[model samples]
Target: METKIREAGTGCGCPGNNAGALSSSTKGCCSPPDDVSGKYAVSCCGPESVTARPAGNQAEKRRLDIEFMYLDLSVCTRCRGTEKNLEEAVSEVARILEAAGFEVKLHKIHVQNEEQALALGFVSSPTIRINGRDIQLDVRESLCESCGDLCGEDVDCRVWVYQGREYTVPPKGMIIDAILREVYGGPAGAVHAPSKMEALPDNLKRFFAARRNKET
Candidate 1:
């Protein structure tokens, strides 16, 4: 089969056409800020997908699936920063993985509502999963001013913990380490799959509800 890529929500209203500049007035969830180099842009107002096949016609190639799910890239600073870091990490490893006969696929999912969040088993805003496993298993969150402004209410976004240090935006090294571990294997008892959530977390529920109320 020929390699195919499908993307959705590529054209949701966002200021500056996905410019890197941060804006407190941006009105939607689909906007992804451009990186500093002006070379990378993620257009995700909804769910977006990309499948990159290895160069050469091989009958079959190993696949590496990466999913980035976020609540609001347009205004959520945490989400925007995480998205940038994730993209960088992927780019850094793309050539190496491709040369190793791995076909990389990335899915950028914008969780706009409670139902969507529940459906994706999303427990927090701005999550990264490699091969169906969350890069960080423990979910923690802190108040997000940008998102709070977007919805007219306070909201909590993800906080990444690496080596006992908490960061609002996940470090590139932490993401790279997770990817390498998934590809090359980690500790003997590492969790290889994401845990299922029965319901959307209350924090997310509040954010979604507040956003809906604001839009109406």
Candidate 2:
């Protein structure tokens, strides 16, 4: 499939005729910020998507301050679909908020096992969370058998694919809507909690507990 390149606007600081830099692997894409100073940074990836930091005070005024967590495998087919949906959702939301003078955050949930999946009540791939809450309209049981169908492992799942490429991020409009929902206290959506076993290597139990408490 041919990858499309979208133009960036002045606000994004994109150069003429292009939104941002693209990977040589892909046609052209919006590049992430050179430096991510805070919790997040606004990235001008392409015309389809742009990442930006949440404008705390401004967002509060626009009432669009919320954190979005996306649950998906790093390389699962179905999970990729979910990621695409989320990316579109987030990108849309970002554009909306930007127009409204608001901001949002995009977070990635890397689930490793059934325990973590169960904790977040993930019924399907690419689960979305708003402020640690699940936002999927449907709820189903998660399945993990093998990955042999797609690649190395036996557990395999189908994700969304638009043009043969697994969208690591979503388009613009969806993101804006998500943020709007979160700001108004709609629901943080489903929360993907790391399992006891999936804890970070650098962090011991104590550290994990502390971080978990904060997230909760």
Candidate 3:
């Protein structure tokens, strides 16, 4: 099967891209910034996904970071399920990514306030990001009864569309599809089973900004 790979991130190392530590470079990548602590500086941050290898290890090891951002995991069943979904997704192809010398790190972030959400560029709760980019960029903010009370009213939670079906929590396959895209970007086609990861929704940034302002 000819796997149609959908590339993720900004292809890395671009002038305008996030300067996270990664081995791969597209145009201009893998340069360490002078400042590592600043928000704009983009440090390796968490141990889950640092590109640097152990000193004297010799063998090249790539860092693959995955983050699952949610509003409040305790109050939201959907968000809780997403955590499991992500685990299953990563487990599906853990060896594939690892064999490619990728040290996989999975994390969960709780966005309790609007400020944190805005700062992190969170489109909605239950959002998943690989590297510094969203897995699926089509962010839908819909009323979630599960977390409505927690939001002080009816909260607009995140939604995902998988296999032509709408789901409150992302399907495991959707995440696997996304990981494959990042795993095999560009001319380096998929070495294993072919999978499809659809592109992000166009012009979603405008909505991200609009949503932030409206809620703030």
lDDT of 2 by residue, 1-216 (tens): 222232111111101111223343433335555443434544465454545643333222222223333333554444565566666766655665567444455556665444554444433344555544444332322232322322333231322223343343433344445456555444222222332223222211222244345457
Best by lDDT: 1
Question: Which has the better TM-score: candidate 1, or candidate 2?
Answer: 1
Worst 10 residues of 1 by lDDT: 10-19
The alpha-carbon RMSD values of the candidates against the true structure, listed in the order shown, are 21.8, 21.2, 16.5
TM-score of predicted model 1? Answer: 0.68
Better of 2 and 3 by lDDT: 3
Alpha-carbon TM-score of each model against the true structure: 0.68, 0.38, 0.59
Question: What 10-residue stretch in candidate 3 is worst by lDDT?
Answer: 10-19
Order the candidate numbers by TM-score, best to worst: 1, 3, 2
Best by TM-score: 1
lDDT of 1 by residue, 1-216 (tens): 111111112111111111133235563455565344434455565335222323333334566777899888788899999999999999999888767556667889988777777667777778887766777776777788899999999788888878877889999999989888866773322333434556766777898889889989
Q: Count the backbone clashes (under 3 Å) in each candidate.
A: 2, 50, 2
lDDT of candidates 1 onward, in order: 0.70, 0.39, 0.59
lDDT of 3 at 101: 61
